[model samples]
Target: MSFIPRRPPRHLLRLLVLLAVAALLYFYSAPVFNAAARSLIRVDAPAPADVVIALGGDARCMRERRAAEIFNRGLARHVIVSGVPYAWGVHTGDAAKRYVESLGVPAERITVLRDAWNTRREAMDVNELMRAQGWNRAILVTSPFHSRRAHYTFRRYAAEYTFISMPLEPEPPEWQPERWWSRRGDLGITVREYLSWINTLAGGWR
Candidate 1:
């Protein structure tokens, strides 16, 4: 048998400590997942925007709910549903329309865009729609956690369009995470966002 030299006592202790920290990070990130998802998914009334924008993912639920609310409030004459569909069946647009219909928004008032491939695509698509259709302003609907990223992405894509956030605060916290820096998963999101920001700074490519 090959003589595998044993690790030193101090090294072994450090190894064990790292294992424990890895475990803590794994479990600790779940709370971040909860925080991000919880902050992102919401059910609420829509704020006033010339056009209502719903981003992809769980925010769809918020979009649908807010769409109906805004329609009823007469805040905006048009609602734009962004995101593409998967083969799994219900596309975001269809789902959004069904949701708004439940709230009594006429079919004519809702416009669904299954072609929006991403956040950048949605912003570009909506801006194009604004030019062709004469929509001067718009309300962007998304979850609270995502509001900042979504806004930055959209603002970059549609510089001419006036943007207003209609974020649905599902579990709006009284205070944000105090030790957020120690939270690795939270950092994961921020890191990803920072990388994106850096990429934008380099070229600002869509």
Candidate 2:
């Protein structure tokens, strides 16, 4: 009897193929995902605007700091802190304005729009303020992950004046898209932002 080497079974071959494909996907497609995640963020400090708007929701005060920095740099003489009072028993705009003031921005230069419940509402409030104040341009500040949706919503609602979307410094755990899939928290943030971005594109933000 002649001994013959048997070929791998078809089922085993199929399993091996799937494993190879998964490995390839994980290794080769990671950079693409990272680039996509980063694309949702935009940080542009344009020429001085009429006002700086810090869209509140950052418990870390990053947005307020950025707005203050911009104000101190002479980018804008006025800063408007925009958000509703959902936490801390104080209007979000008020809290943000206080923080900015603490950072050396003059209180008189600080304005608060405390009626915004969401991005759309913030856009509405900002637009009304701009028209009332005869302002022509604004710098919109928010967390990096939220920059895209915020920019989209604001542009959609405030079409008259120029709105520059400024994303804060990308801190880890909240803005790390490259390592997003490795951690549940980062992944959740990335996914949530993507969903909100899609909603904004679909005109669903009410």
At residue 28, what lDDT does model 1 achieve?
Answer: 92
Candidate 2 C-alpha lDDT tens digits along 1-206 = 99999999999999999999999998978898889888888777678899998886777778889899989999997998866767667676777888889999999999888776778888988888999999998998888888878887888888898988877867762577675677887788889888887777787857
Residue pair clashes in candidate 1 = 51-138
Clashes of each: 1, 0
lDDT tens readout by residue for model 1, 144-203 = 555666777777878888777777643432112334455575555545655655665575
Clashing pairs in 2: none
Off by over 4 Å in 2: 1-20, 87-89
Q: On a 0 to 100 scale, what is the lDDT of residue 115 in model 1? A: 76
